[model samples]
Target: MLNYRLFGDLSSSAAPLVVLHGLLGSLDNWHTFARGQAGKRTVLAIDLRNHGDSPHVAGMSYRQMVDDVVAVLDTLAIPECYLMGHSMGGKVAMMLALQHPSRVRRLLVVDIAPKAYPPRHQALLHAMVGMPLGELSSRKQADEWLSATVKHPFERGFLLKNLGRKTEGQFYWQCNLPEIARHYLKISGFPTTDAVYPAPTLFIRGGQSDYVADTDLPMIRQAFPAAELVTVAAAGHLPHVQTPAEFTVLVEAFLG
Candidate 1:
């Protein structure tokens, strides 16, 4: 089963919200957003296979990832849930709602559209895999090393979260980088399906991020016809992190 963290009251009458994070991210990434909305309803943020504290095996396909999520929901005894995901996770959420519409009460996709994207993470993943983990004594050195390819401090720090130190004084990546690298192509494309989800849906895009464009909406509406697209004008790829208050308002208004 996939690893999961819970937020808010379990006894709350509202249906639980299941959150998934982006590529190279873990459930920890959603901690701030989950905590902020904890009082309103329960939030179950999950670590997709090969991410965070979840068990890592081989497959990284969206279908396999969706199966992993379905298994988690079954294990938790949650028949239905409000679903949300960011970036790569957003694609997973879209696939889940498309495949199992009855299990999702509402869907929220952050900063991504339900379509195939060109492979853009090749350099980043290569830099990470080629990093000298053994020679790195501190995160500072690792950051400096990665700075050759990853210039932005925000992205550098985010990816570095998967780096961990063992009790024996050895550092290792917490995520399955090799597996992710191996299936990067599969992760970039979405599954072709004629399925459509008719439930309430929200698609929030970071205005500064070109991940989702106005041109993608007609195609997005084709899959999630009920989807309402909104732009977080001041934010980039991570709207929730860049502008928490505004993000919260949008989430609350949509879920309510």
Candidate 2:
């Protein structure tokens, strides 16, 4: 089962809010958002397969990831919940809602359209997978080396979250980097399903992010006809992280 963190009461009268992180992200990345929502309802932050503390499996298919989450929900006895996700996780949420509409009472997708994206992270994946973990003695060294390919401080730090220490004290990547690289195209592509999720849904995008283009709206509307779109002007790619207060407000308003 996928590793997950649950907050709020198990018997909370409200359906839980299940949050899924983006590519190269773990449950820890959504701590702020989950905590903010947990105050009013149960919140489940899950580490998708091959990321974070979850098992490092070979495939990264949205179907597989969706099932992984379903397995966790089944284990926890959560019949349905307010589901949300960011980027790649957004795709998973979209798939889950479409594949299992009864399990999602409401849906919130962040910064991703229900269409395929080109393979943009291959170079970065290769860089991370090809890192000399055996020679790196410190996280600082890893950061310095990664800086060669990943220049932005924030993104570099975010990617470094995958670094884990072996029992012998050597640094290793906890995320299944090699397999992610191999299935980069699959990850970029959306799942093959003509099914649409006819539920009250909200799509939040970062004004500074190009991940969700205006051109993608028709397709998004087609798949999620009940979807409402919102943009956080001050944020880019990661509005929940960049503007937590504003994002939290939007989420709460939607849930209500």
Cα deviation at 193, candidate 1, in Å, is 0.5
Q: Write the per-residue lDDT of candidate 2 for residues 116-169, one digit (tens) a residue.
A: 888888878888988999999899999998888998999999999999998798
Which candidate leads the pack in TM-score?
1
In candidate 2 the C-alpha lDDT for residue 252 amounts to 90
Off by over 4 Å in 1: none
What tens digits encode model 1's per-residue C-alpha lDDT throughout 1-256? 8999989756655679999999999999899999987567899999999999999899899999999999988987888999999999999999999999999999999999988899998999999999999898888999998999999999899999999999988889999999999999999999999999999999999989999999998999998999899999999999988898899899999988
Which of the numbered candidates is closest to the native, going by highest lDDT? Answer: 1
TM-score of each: 0.98, 0.97
Candidate 2 lDDT at 172 equals 86
Give Cα distance to truth, residue 226, candidate 1, Å: 0.7
Clashing pairs counted in every model: 0, 0
lDDT of each: 0.93, 0.91
Cα RMSD to native, each candidate?
0.9, 1.1
lDDT of 2 at 244: 92
